[model samples]
Target: MLQPKARKAASPSFTSDEKVKRSTFSLRLTKSKKEKHMSHDKTSLPNAGPSYKGQPASVAKEDGARRRARPQTEVPAVFRRSRDDYSRGEVKVSSFSSPVGSSVDHEEEEEDIYRDVDEIEREREWLVCGTGAAVSPGNTLSVAPEVDILDYCQVEWRGSTSSAKRMRKGYEAVSQRFISIRRVRGDNYCAVRATLFQALSQTLQLPDWLQNQDLMLLPEKLMAKCTWITEWQKLPAKAENWTEEMKACLLLLKRKWESISEKKTLAERQAACDALFRGEEEEYSLYEAVKFLMLNTAVQLYEDNQKGLEVPEFSWLLFARDTSSDPFQLMQNHLNPLGHTGGLEQVEMFLLAYALQHSIHVYRLYKHGTDEFLSLYPRLPEAGWPEVILITEDDRHYNIPVRMCEETSL
Candidate 1:
């Protein structure tokens, strides 16, 4: 062979582009040589070695044998797993390849997160408001149907020393027969709630019609029974000029009441009534209805009590009217059951007392100074009266334990 020309030593110095090209070519050449060698070696290998075909089967068999070798125990299907199961990371990657699977997984995760959030929110509401089922989508009232009056009322005893002594003496005298004191909330419905609590406690079975009835509808029901309270009856004989507006209001109220009574659902009825009360023209109708109900109901109860038509202890209607108040005129002002500050007037209290009749005794407690305590007894007192008592302080009312009688009756 002609002596190979002296191979020039490879030069290290080169342009950047040229250097890159040379390196690439060298890598390709080396890869090709290695592949050729590997192919030749594979071809020359003996066929007597272990066959890959049987190797997979043997491995699978061995795995099955190992699994069977272990003692089996009963485990819930949810907790059970096989060696073939993919890890969470692998499953996540696979989920990405399948659109439906990915969407389903995402939805499941979202549901889990929502469930956790709902649980946390429910706990927070219970702790903060102390109300169960306080929030609902369509229900308006936040109050629970069954509530413990004592849970909401706060008690503070304050009075003069002499008053306290007097209260103590009264308590000692009544201690032998006195039951306990109960309190209620101080809203317009306070009197109603207080009186009802006493009545319900005494009655072995509440009237089916009254049992599930909304307390707010009492005025409306009473209005239905007493229709003579319209403006015609209330207006002065000389001032009986029939205004078109007044006639229209009376007609509208009649139709509204009919619609309300026809509504099948409580929510529907409440919404209809609310709408009527909200209307500027019809708003007065609600006031008139409630006023007449209060006046007539009170008068009826008073008359009934006088006639002894029913026993005082079992009567469900009782009212003691003020000596100098005009019942019809009283209805013109402060007859709003929806009002926050207006409904707790003496008139409303009288109405509630009349409704409760002799079912319960109301004890009005007063605290004038540091150590003075006074208890005002109910107007009607009869033998074997129910033991329920409600206390009022600064117009705030609540139920208290009968056993904790510090200062009693006056």
Candidate 2:
């Protein structure tokens, strides 16, 4: 090598020391190429793509790998817009495609707007009822027109008879009891009597024979007259109770059964029977007529007590016995004495008589299924009344035409 020192190759020869160095450099270059190929493959990956290209080639890429997975929806760039004068927040158009002021009709955008609005709404329905799902009232719409529920309502009816008296009386009665808790109690004596008679008359279902009679024949006020009822209630209950005179008046009541029992021992029933034949015109008087029946029946009862020839004995005498009272005493002494026709029937009649005397309000409904019916409707503003509406089957609306009152019978 010393002899050839002058012959050093320009590119360097394969000398022992030089060859080792050359081989090491070749190895390093090969390794570097392999690393470059790996980096290129990484950049070509489906996700980890796009290596930084604008940098020194000697150095490996320094940019970090993609991290966020979500699609970026950056706001549009701030462009000169008319709405800018009244806008808020920073606008970024990094990804926004539409121009700030441009009129771009996009189906995607329209769909998005509708979607957002639908998500925010609280009420939504898919109705398939009434009118074959064509109408929209009772169901609200947002975009164009709102369906009106009032338009779809249908309540069909009409009025027949307009009852003024009933309306007035009802209003008065209801007014009196508007604040009252009792089913039908009244502070006014007149009101109470009116109410009671109203109830009684309805119960009795009195025929015209009794109902049409003159009410003033009695010296004292009587229940037969509607107005008289109000006055009658004013009299103390003690005064109305039977007195000795009153008891005497009802004497025929005691003798009624006596004649049926002891016939032979008793006076003839002819006197009483004859009186009945005589008093066809209400002339003999209630007191005298009753007395005549008593005298005839008294003898009859005395005779029946000794003989038991009639039907099976009834024990009504235990509850209805009244031997001590003479006429009633016959039934009491004889456990099988005949009794009155029917207590319930008589009581009902009396109650009816009581009712006709009181009620100021009366409705004369037709008998035997007549079409005549009283219809009630709520009052209207045209009727010159306040806001009181009564809706009935007759389908008429009116103000509170009738005030309510405390009623004994309704």
* lDDT of candidate 2 over 335-374, digit per residue (tens): 1111100011111111222222221211111110221122
- Compute the lDDT of residue 112 as modeled in candidate 1: 23
TM-score of each: 0.31, 0.13
**What's the TM for model 1?**
0.31
Q: Write the per-residue lDDT of candidate 1 for residues 1-410, one digit (tens) a residue.
A: 45533312221111112101111100000000111101010100111110001001111111110000122222221211221221111111111111111122232222122124454344225321211111223333312232222222211212344434433433333232233333232223344444433333333333332333343354344344433234222222222333333334334444554556566654454355444422132444433433344455554543454455553321221111111122222332223212222233322443544433332333233232222132212333333334344444323333333332222333
- List the lowest-lDDT window of 10 residues for candidate 1: 23-32
Q: Highest lDDT among the candidates is held by which one? A: 1
**How many backbone clashes are present in model 2?**
42
RMSD of each: 42.5, 53.5
How displaced is residue 391 in candidate 2, in Å? 34
Question: What is the alpha-carbon lDDT of model 1 when measured against the actual structure?
Answer: 0.30
The local distance difference test score of each candidate is: 0.30, 0.20
